[model samples]
Target: MSSTLLAPVLEREEYIEQAYFFRTLAERLREGVPAQMALLQIRDELLTTTRLPWAVEFLATELKHSGQLGSGMKRLIHYFTPFQAFVMTKAEEEGVRFSLDHALKVLEGEARYRSENPTPAGLFVYEFEVLARCQLGYQNGLDCMEQDSFFDEDWRQFIETVRRSMSEVEFADLIYLYSEQYIQDQQRAGREGPFPRPLFGLKEGRIAKASHGRDPLYLFAALQRQLGYPEVPRLRLPTEQRGVLQMLEHKVRELELRLRLLEGEVRGQVEVIQALGKPETAESSLEWLKRLDNEE
Candidate 1:
């Protein structure tokens, strides 16, 4: 086989080992083992194993095969890959630090992709690919909770802040998207007693009646408007709203600043004109200026 082809397979082998380690820890955690202990075990495994660089190479290879590597993944590889690497290889100039929890989260996220779309014999491979990324991010001290983006620091903070600030209705919507029956029970209980303040307040009889027979999209739209959020597109994903809101807030601030600047410029021009002399008539003055400019 060509070294180009054999290279990925070699990387896959390293990923397989790391994936096994992560899965072992995950199983122990599920069985009520202390997180510290599990982490120690993971750390011990890392210490005794081949160098981390080799492990990372394996992961990059596996990610290539899984197609989970999107533009975000490419950017990540570009910053870290090496010469003759199937992906870009640049030296790791900047250092990153991350908690073990962050590493686990990244691993779990990748593992989830496998569960969401299963394939035979490839299960372990998928897990390994994800663990490799988690390891890379951990080494880099990057926050794995955030989605990959060009602006790492800003985007990470934005995602975490948005997740924390999610309204009860938005939280419920998220839960509903993932689990319908659980949300229904929560709604029913809210209506019956101690009516918890829901973000959407759909528990209110009047609101429900008004929203009756509406589709989820329409209901969500009304809720968004009521909550003073911008009108979102009907087909947009729920997870996408936080990023959208951040962009909107950025744009709104920019526009506000521009408006203030324009107002100041206009005021300065008006002061200059007033200093010159009171216009014979505001309309006539404007007309005269236009005529003068046209003549020039």
Candidate 2:
């Protein structure tokens, strides 16, 4: 990763404000506020002393011109992490199932974690969980994680190694091998050669060992449950929201049927015209209704 591409580690207050900004923006979006409007509104809510307000202003300007928040964020690499920009970019992509609200919530959780005294190991787990759970491409996701200034050189090297051979290696084994417990066991067995520095603690190693050969999500769950690591947010619409979406889908299907009927009428299909037009006989009208139902 290029040094210039990586944003410097931000202050605790900056992260605090960022968490607030993301959380507020996501909430507003869920409530149906426009993105540009949300940014303008959030700009005034940020601390005047922090650089976030200026970034918000620029984002608003960019949103007006290009109608995309990710484009603006990508240009502000000096302020936002590459991972943040990448998440927003994915959210805004056409045909991607990921929602912008979910992306903001992800960033909000990350910033909130950063505001606290977060350990490098915990931060790495949280980030990796996001990539895994969201099905974000591991290649770019690991690259972004590696470039984050919050992690040191050792962490970057390990992350790059994971990116290269993630498909070949078992995730649990990877964690266990780099853990202190592994080193202790090796020393007890009288192994002679030097070992790489341990990135995970003994407890993490034990969890990984227990979770071996299982789904990696199990390992992530154990870490969050036992070690107080930050949990990645899952995107699920509420019951009411899902119902509304179903209703809209039904309405769209109805519209499509009507459009098809119109096209058939234009082409002078006798059955389509009879289905759409009033019939002279009640029996004919019943037959038309039956045909329409069958088409539906």
- Pick the lDDT winner: 2
Model 1, 122-174: lDDT tens per residue?
23222223323323322122223232222234333433443454433342243
Clashing pairs in 2: none
Residue ranges of candidate 2 with Cα displaced over 4 Å: 2-4, 239-296
Error (Å) of candidate 1 at residue 282 is: 99
Per-residue error at 152 for model 1, in Å? 17
lDDT of 2 at 36: 88
Mind giving the per-residue lDDT tens digits that candidate 2 earns over 1-296? 53435667998999999999999998888889988899999999999999999999999999899989999988998899989998999999988788888898899999999999899998898888888898878889888888788878888889888988899998888889899989988989999558888999999999998988899998999899998989998877778799898778766655665575677667766575665665444335446556666765
Question: What clash pairs does model 1 have?
Answer: 11-58, 81-89, 82-89, 96-140, 96-141, 97-140, 97-141
Give candidate 1 regions above 4 Å deviation: 1-18, 24-53, 56-146, 149-170, 175-296
TM-score of each: 0.21, 0.81
Clashes of each: 7, 0
Question: RMSD in angstroms, all models?
Answer: 20.3, 6.3
